[model samples]
Target: MSVDFGQIRRNEHLPARIAAQIGSDIQEGRLKPGDKLPTEHFLAKSLGVSRSVVREAIAQLRNEGLVETRQGVGAFVTERQSRTIRIDEGELFKRDSFRDLFQLRIPLEIEAAGLAAVHYKEADLERIDEALARMTGSEKWTDEGIDADLAFHRAIAEATGNDYFALFIGFIAERISLAIAAARARVELEEIVNVTIDEHVVVRNAIASRNPKAAREAMRAHLLGAASRVDLTLETY
Candidate 1:
């Protein structure tokens, strides 16, 4: 049998069809907030779907918080839904998917730390030490913690003397913030930051000691430790 993508959409079962049309209507602003949807029967007839299908589609929208239903009145549109969607060649923004971003972070960060150990200058070490001090006095480990934490990592990346890898660090900062925000508590944040600082110091010390292998090892330990602490589903990757 032949297949047509457009026909497939047109022939989709009732619930999916209703969902697509309503979703499209909302997308096109034909369905504005406070707009009452037609009754289930009307929708079913109009869309050539069973009333159950209409109800199911409405339920789906309700679950998405795009519509509100009164006890005996009707379903009305709500504000348009928003999703975590953006494309910056390289930039960080608050988002809902940090796990995916962390997948890109730990290894890149650890590797950058190792490189920093090899290539960092006295000035670089001083800069990193200053950033580290900022972490030492921090109280709550929330957004402030995330800022300090990413800053420390960025410092290591800068110490690496590689600009592109540092760009990778910039890419995931916001995503890491999401996971960091979901952490155990403020103290937990401080603890992780402290632990990371220790790891970073070890890496830096190894580099300063001119032990490249030890620097790499220390960097790896820091990231893997972070993975375990964060329960990063992406640690294995």
Candidate 2:
């Protein structure tokens, strides 16, 4: 079968863009389940990208359960009728897209924090504390520190006793972390890092106190502060 793959523009996150485009094809029924994807060499040539980018894009589709690869054969669309939610990384760089994502994040995370406050076990608390400690101990401007920050939030999501919550928070947090890292790049890194740590501490303290309302409010404040740090203006409600 002939596939009309578009040539990719040179930009950051090339692989993700390719994956998003192919994923769109799958979701829209243009690429049926069991339809084999073009070879890496062909995709690379068609898209005007390197074979490595094509490989990574295929890897992404596999991770999202939209595609399955057979050894030495090729990649084909998965038989699953539904595709998992995916945020196009390229869109995250756009102002409106970032704002929309952050807006969605507010209610979801606020609720997650409240639920965590109500349901968190001692072990959950320890995980949260461990992540916090790692963030505090790591270099302020390093990827390790950012990862620790994500872990801290993930721990709270896990504490909610909801696997879906954990899954979504993990996905959204990963994408937002990219935006956060970019924002941090343009400012006083040390200052932003310190403020972020302080905000996390407030959220953690509220959860630890087992006050759902307080935890919710703390999370709201922290998320709002995060958006502001990124120079994005979001409605406060």
Best lDDT goes to which candidate? 2
Per-residue CA lDDT of candidate 2, range 99-212, in tens? Answer: 798888888899999999999999999999998998889544675576677778889999999987886776677566655566566568888889999999999999999999
Per-residue error (Å), model 2, residue 223:
0.5
Clashing pairs in 2: none
The lDDT values for all models are 0.60, 0.79
lDDT of 2: 0.79
In terms of TM-score, the best-performing candidate is 2
**Whole-model lDDT, candidate 1?**
0.60
Candidate 2: list runs displaced more than 4 Å. Answer: 1-82
Worst 10 residues of 2 by lDDT: 1-10
Q: After superposition, which runs of candidate 1 have C-alpha atoms over 4 Å from their true positions?
A: 1-97, 138-142, 184-194, 235-237
Residues 153-237 of candidate 1 have per-residue lDDT tens digits of 6677778898766656654543344344444332344566667667767866776776667877787776666655655545453
